[model samples]
Target: MSASNQGRIGVLLVNLGTPDSPQTPDVRRYLNEFLTDARVVDMPAAIRYPLFRGLVVPLRAPKSAKIYQQLWTERGSPLLYHGLDLQKRVQEQLGNDYLVAFGMRYQNPSVESALQELRDAAVSRIIVLPLFPQYAAASTGSVQEKVMDIVSKWWIVPSISFISNFVDEPGFIETFAMLGKAEMAKHDYDHIVFSYHGIPERHVLKGSHNGYCKLGNCCNSYNKNNRYCYRAQCFETSRQLGKALGLTPEQYTTTFQSRLQSRLRDPWLQPYTDEVIKEYPAKGIHNVLAFSPAFVADCLETTIEVGEEFKELFEEAGGKHWQLVPSLNSEPMWVEAVAGMIRRN
Candidate 1:
């Protein structure tokens, strides 16, 4: 091969990550690492580090560990295994011409290690797919920042590209629409809910295009002004998925989930998943099907938080058959969705 074609392209699949094990220590370590990151906490090191170490990690770790315990499986975390399966599938799909690897933003199978592998392969360029359908600073933003931080240190950095958000990508929509179709066939659900992972309102404003994100009705319609807005992208994801699922505007609701307040009276995204489900019972919506497209893998957030906890909440609020549509894991369609994204990049 000529010098211009000396190296193969590298593809890195990144997910948020999970604790090494379900144990409290591991969970605590994971939480500490995750929350301490400035991208996540979005606080100064002097203030954030002490608060996370002294208060947040100590209080939330044990509870989170139990949740991770519930989320754990013999194959290990759903996020990790599914990511590995995706890596293998994408590699096979692309054949010998390309190389693929999976990395976690925190804990085992670190991004640094994955990048090292790619460097060893001597890939001339890297394509990063941060397994988030919607763009958010805390998720995809953090992943891209980490990748940039790592590769910039290299003596010979290759060209790098990131697929920031694919909220409306055809394969992504197809995979999610396909899952919704199966779930709908199983039950006569009274309502449909699209719950994306929540980020702080401030983060939304920070990424706002020319002060475009008012966090009010701006998310109601997606446009050029709010193209990179997390809230807008989420709403757009729901809109596209709704069209594919044959759902009218009144047939479903878009909401947010898994919010963590960074400061006193600090609000994360509104129309929260928990609050939304509670109101469903009063509206005589007994049965509901939920979709968490922000999460590509069935991790603690999807399987436990959305599937179990929200189901319990909905039931306690006097609803029946609160079912969560499983995430787009390593199934063939999802694999194709992922593979197609990588190949296109």
Candidate 2:
């Protein structure tokens, strides 16, 4: 191919999706597609297939739709809006050299569409960056799988590269710390909680390197064996952010949130969010600040779960104050950080 025909470089930003509408049918469609993914649910189809199709989707969709409705804005899903904004900001930062596109893994503006846009643009080199800062089989791995799957059928596939996880990236950590400190300065918080979205224990073990991850101190302490470990990554993210914010180990805690039903001996990150809120009073911890660094965009999880639900629980538990640090959204600094990452790659 001629040099002129090779085309521009392309960057696709992918995120977990939101429903097409705040309606049960739409939510069901989105949830069914999301939960059915083997990467997300992580159970064999023989087991999860019926459970997802027959039970969860049917029962949860309507309820989830209600929750999503509460999160919807004039522009539509907060996730979609912020993601679109991020795309524009990143593109503007990178100037005209790169073609930028955004996609939701489970809904409209699908990965297929995004990839097609890049392909049609004749992008010679394509970079896939999942918005998830931390890597998990269900999130980053799934995005990678989908990208490869789509490219596999193409007549001419571009030179594709995937940015797996940038949890420890200097710019990313700095952005997170800056946000956390800004939130903390507003009040005297006795506890700073780093709450990450939870994955099933089986999912963690599945990714473990020959039983290397016990999901305990072994996971918390940084070591080569557990370097790519998702649980470990969460801790490291918390630690780095704490250090940047000048928080001592005693002032901060790391835990997991949003766990679905599962029976596994291996613990998800300790001191679940609710438990942490409830225990804080007894421990003499009054004001609490929560940071959900795992999420790059504000969504139902951060808006409803952390902002409202957890705030209610914390207040009801005799805690004086409960505050949530907002997601990065389209902050100029965050856009610059992401743009820097793309350029470095």
Candidate 3:
């Protein structure tokens, strides 16, 4: 293709988002927007708004501010910096022909701004890649919804494409496997934990096509039946990583974490990471290595929650050691993977 033809193509990368700063007010603003998203909370505004704004935000913001403070770097939030770096590398790989831009779903460098940049370039087509490896209504789906909502109002809309998920993509799987392998090489851990973000159990059943996702070994394999099921995809991701790392079923446990409050009748994904960690010692698994494949970059969830908070939990439960494998975050392999996806699309 000629340079002109390729330059007409625009690539917009999106991630979940981060607070503008580690300050309590900034974090609260971010939380307010994020938690208020119907897809994320799955409740009516009258109820969700008051519960999150009145209760959750007020109680959690200060504590979350402290955690984000720990994660802030010289460049700012690790998630934001990593995302910016990833955008730069992808642009470099695609060269000047492709206008590769990035934005977050919630906070600064908003999706609206990024879409405006691509629209200003007068590109003929735009490809949106939500950085979440799995397809979740709250994350990848929300990005798509917002993008469409914005572009639908444009006087002259461009051809927009979206990469919803790449959980089973070879490049995606290999990149995480490589990261996990390097960590495993450094020490022999008694167990491996694959902890993904929790979603309401209702979320899974809500989208199930004729009850396909029973949430058992049904997710051990991915097919058209459970293709969009986030829980299934998470399990399949763990399965792929296990094969790459030569791990037997007994050596690893797949669980969910970071669950927000829900009604007693409603349950999120089970084998909750925190609860499971406390039980590891009694099961004779003292040391553990965790992989947060759900995240492409090390954010609060991976850094503070998994690496620090969960590590403390394991140790307090009489466990000897706990280590979290670093995320792919702007790694060369991941950059190539993303570039390849754009080219393929």
- Top model by lDDT, which number? 3
Evaluate model 3: give its TM-score: 0.97
Return whichever of 2 and 3 wins on lDDT. 3
Task: Give model 3's clash tally.
Answer: 0
lDDT tens per residue, model 2, 222-246? 6778777888899999988889989
lDDT of 3 at 74: 91
Per-model TM-score, in order, reads 0.97, 0.96, 0.97
| Candidate 3: stretches off by over 4 Å | 5-7, 262-265
Give the 10-residue window scoring lowest on summed lDDT in candidate 2. Answer: 261-270
Q: Sort the candidates on lDDT, descending order.
A: 3, 1, 2
lDDT of 3 by residue, 108-187 (tens): 89999999999999887999999999999989999999999999999999888899999988888899889888988899
lDDT of 2 at 150: 89
lDDT of 2: 0.88
Q: RMSD of each candidate?
A: 1.6, 1.9, 1.4
Q: Score candidate 3 by lDDT.
A: 0.91
